[model samples]
Target: MTKSGNVLQKINNNYDELSERYNFTILPRSTRWNSVNRLGFSSTYLIRQGRVIEAIEVAELYTEYQPKSWQAYESLAKAFEANEDNLQALKNVKIAVRLVDNEVNKSLLLAYINQGDRVNMQLRSVKSLTLICLMLFLMVLTACNNDSKLDFDAFVEKKLTDFLIEENAQVASIAIVNDKLNYQKQFGEFPDGTKPHHDTVYEIASITKTYTGLLLAKAVVDKKVQLDEDIRVYLQDGDYQNLQHLGKPITLRHLATHRSGLPQDFAYTSADIKSGKAFELFSNYSEAKFFEDLAQYQLTSMPGETFQYSNVGANLTGYILENVYNQPLSTLVAQLITEQSGEEHTRFRLEPSEISKITRGVDRNGKIAPLLSPHSFAEGGLTSTAASIADYMQYLLSTQAEEVLLSRTLLTETSSEHGHAFFWNTYEYHSANPMFYHSGGSIGTSTWLALYPKQKLGIFIATNVSANNTQGKLNDIANAIVEKYEQVGQSK
Candidate 1:
C-alpha cells in the first residue's frame, strides 16, 4: 500500500476503536473503497503536500483502474496545473465535472482552471454569479417582508423601561428590514467572565448551520453548483465508496436539508477542541478536515430518508460552498449573506472587543458564559438584535418581491422547509395557530422569531439570557400576537 493508503488504514483503525463508545455505524458499500481512484487520491494528497508528479500519477491511475471515477480526472487536472501541465488539467477537468455531477465540486473544478484552458463548458449567468446574497435578496422581496417607517423608534426609547439593559444586557442598534426587524443586543462579561462591554460576541453554536443552508440554496440558483448530484465527484479522491451505498447518492440538497447522513461534529470533549490541550478529538478539523471526515461518515439513513440533525453534515455544506468559491466560509458570509441580508451590523464571533456592539448568550439556567466565533458560523456563530433577526425572516417569509430578490420558485413547498430548523413551517404553541419561524439560544442569549406569511405578520425577540420557562412565555407571546393578527385579518 502507498504511504497515504497506509495512513488511511491506521486512521480507520483508530476511528473503529473510538466507535466502541457509541453504537458505530458501518460504512456503506457504495462508499466502500478498494482501488477505484487510486491515481486521483495520490495526486490529491501530493498536490496538497506540494508534490506535482506524484499527483499527476494519482490522476492517471483513475483513467487506468476506475475509468469511470471523475475524481481521478479532476485530480489529474489539478496535478497537471500544479506541474504547470495546464493542458492536461484542462483536458481532465471537463471529464471530472460531468462525471462527478455535483454543483459544489463542479464549481471547485471550474475555479481551479482558467477560462481559455477550460474543456468546452458553457458560461454561467450574472445573477447566478451572485446567487447567495443576490438570489436571497430577490427571493425575500417576494415574501412581503417590506418595512415601513417606524414611529416606534421614538416609542421604544421614550416609553420603554431600561429593564434588560440595567440587568447587564447591552442594547446595540435597532434595524427594520420590512415587517421583520432586529435589535443589536449584548450582555455580560467575556471569556472566563471578565469586565464585558457592548460589543461582546458569543459563539452561536448551531446557528451557523442555518446560514450554511442558505448558501446551499443560493448555489443552486447560481448554477455554479447543483444539489441533485452525487457528492463523490466533488470530493478529493481516496479509496472506497463508489456511490453504491451512498444511501441515495448524497446530494448538496440533502446535505443542506440535513438528510445527507453526515454526523454532527465529531463527538469530542470541550477541552479537546482547544489547541495543545489533550491532542483533542475535533483537533484536526477545519474546512478541509470536515470533508475528510465526511468521506468516512456512515450513512445511517439514505438521502432524503429522514430528519436527523448533524453538525458535521451542515459543516460539510459550508465546506463545499467554500471549496466552490475558493474563499473561506467566513468570507462567503461577509460577501453573500451578511452583506445582502443587511444584517451587516451583526458579527460572527464570541468576544467582547466592542462594548456597544455585541450580545451575550444565556442558557436555560440564565447564566452567562464565554463568547464564540464564526469559525463554525455555518452552524451557529452569529450575534444580532431581535430586529435584525426578524429582518432575515422577512426574506424567508415575504411575498411582496418574491421574484425580485426572494424568488417564489425557490421554495414552493413550505412543508419541505418546516421539518426541523429554519425554513418556513408552522408549529403550534400556547394554543396559537401555526406560526412559521425558528429560535436560537446559547450561554447568555435567547432569540426567537415568528412570521405568518399568510397574514403578513411577524415578531422578533432576543434576550441576553435564557429564560428557563421563557420559551413557553415567548410561545405564549407569539401565539397571542399571531392570533390577534389573524382576527384582524379576518375582520378586514
Candidate 2:
C-alpha cells in the first residue's frame, strides 16, 4: 500500500485515539465530526499528490459518513472538480448549496456552481446554450434593476444584519474611510439589552499588532533601531543562544514580519483558551514571564527564512519598543497613535467609566466570554469603538507621516500573492494597487482591518463574537462592501 493509504488505515483503526489526541470535544458541536474533517483533508492531500481516484474515494467516504452535511458534499465537489468532472462537481455543489444553512457557505457553493456552469456550457448542446443564454439575460436584467435601486448604506446594513443573525452574534461595529467618504455604524444590541452605539468599546484583539508595527516603524525612523539589527542586543539580561539559526540572528524585521523563529504564544495554547485556562494563565503572566520563556525557546528554522504567525514575536517587538523609548507600551500608544489619530476611545487600558462602555462578547456557543486581559497588550489587548476606529482609518488613509508610510512598506515577500510589512499582511505589494490588512481574534471577539493605499480606502470591522471562521466571514463582508462601493463610484 501507498504511504497515504497506510496513514488512512492507521487513522481508521485509531479513531478514538485520534479524537482524544486532538481534543475533538472542544470544537463547535456542528464541526465536531473529526473523522469527516480528517477525511476531507486526506482527499485534498491526495489530490495535491496527483492521486485523483484515491481522492475521490476519500471524499465519497466523507459523504457516506456525513450524508446531510454541506461540507461533505462541498469536499466531494472539489475532488470531482480536481478530476475535471465538471458535471459531477456541479451536481455535488448544487446539493451542497441546498444543504448549506448559512449565507457564507451558500455564497461559496454558489460561486463554485457558477464556475462549473461556465465550464460545462462549452460542452452543452445548442439548445442548452440557448436556454443558458436566456437565463443569463434575465439575470442581467434583474441585476440592472437591483443596481438602479441599490443604497450603499442599506446594502451594508442588510449584510451586517445577516452576518449577526447567521453567527448568532450580539453586536458588530464597522467603519469605512475613503477620500470621498467616512462612514461608521453599529449593529445589534448588547446582552444587557442596551444598543451598541458608535463609541461602544470592544477588544480589537490582534489588530493591536498594527499599532505595535507602526511603533516599530517610528523607532526605525528615529534611528533608535535598525531593521536588521540582532534582537539579542537589547536582551542583555538573558543568554538567548537559541534565538539564532544557521549562524543568522533574528532581527527586529524578522519579528515584525513574522519571520522570527518564535512560537505562536508562550502564555497559553488554543486548547487552554477553549477550556477557560488561558484567562487564568494570563492573569499572572508578565514581561518577566515572557522573557523567561524566550530564554528557553529553540529556533525551529533559520531566522528570516520562514513565516510563522507569532504573537510572542509581536509582544517581544512591543517590549523592545518600550525599552528603546523608555516608556510603557500604553504611554507610547497614547503619544504616537491614538493621540495623533484623534482616536479618543482607542486604548490599551480602560478606566472604570470606559469599562462600562465595553460591549459584552459572545462565543460560538452563545455564552458570554471574558474580555481580553491587558497582559497581551502589545499583541492583542487594545479595545476601541467604531467612531474611534473610523478616526484611525481616516488617519491611515490621509496621513503622509514617514513612520506610517514605512510601516506599510513590504519588508518580506512570503509568496507572489502575499507579503508582510512591519506587521501588516500585504497583497499585490509589487503592483500598482497594493493592500495591507490584518485579522484579529480573541477568546470572545474577532476583527478585521484593511487599507487600500492606492484607493485611499480603509475599513475596520469588529464583532463581539469569536468563532472558528469569524475572520473569513468578516473578510467576505468587507469584500462585498468594497465591491458595492466600487459599483456605486463607477455609476456616479
The most accurate candidate by lDDT is: 2
The CA lDDT of each predicted structure is 0.48, 0.77
CA error at residue 136 for candidate 2, angstroms: 40
Instruction: Tell me the lDDT of model 2 at 183.
Output: 64
How far residue 304's Cα lies from its native spot in candidate 1, in Å, is 1.6
Q: Using Cα atoms with residue i matched to residue i, what is each candidate's TM-score against the true structure?
A: 0.51, 0.68
Choose the strongest candidate by TM-score.
2
Clashes of 1: 82
Task: For residues 6-36, write the lDDT of model 2, one tens digit per residue.
Answer: 3444556776664454332333324223544
Question: Mind giving the per-residue lDDT tens digits that candidate 1 earns over 1-492?
Answer: 322334334435654442332112322213213323333444556677786765665456456443435666766767776786544555576566455523445555554443524332222534324333432443343222212112233233331224344334433222222232223323223446564332233333444455666666566666667767776656555632833254458776566556666655564445553442322333334655654555566665666676555666666666667777778777777666654443434556434455235555554444554344323446666665444454455555542332223321222232533443232223442223344555555545555556555544556554555545533444554455445434433212
Give each model's clash number.
Answer: 82, 0
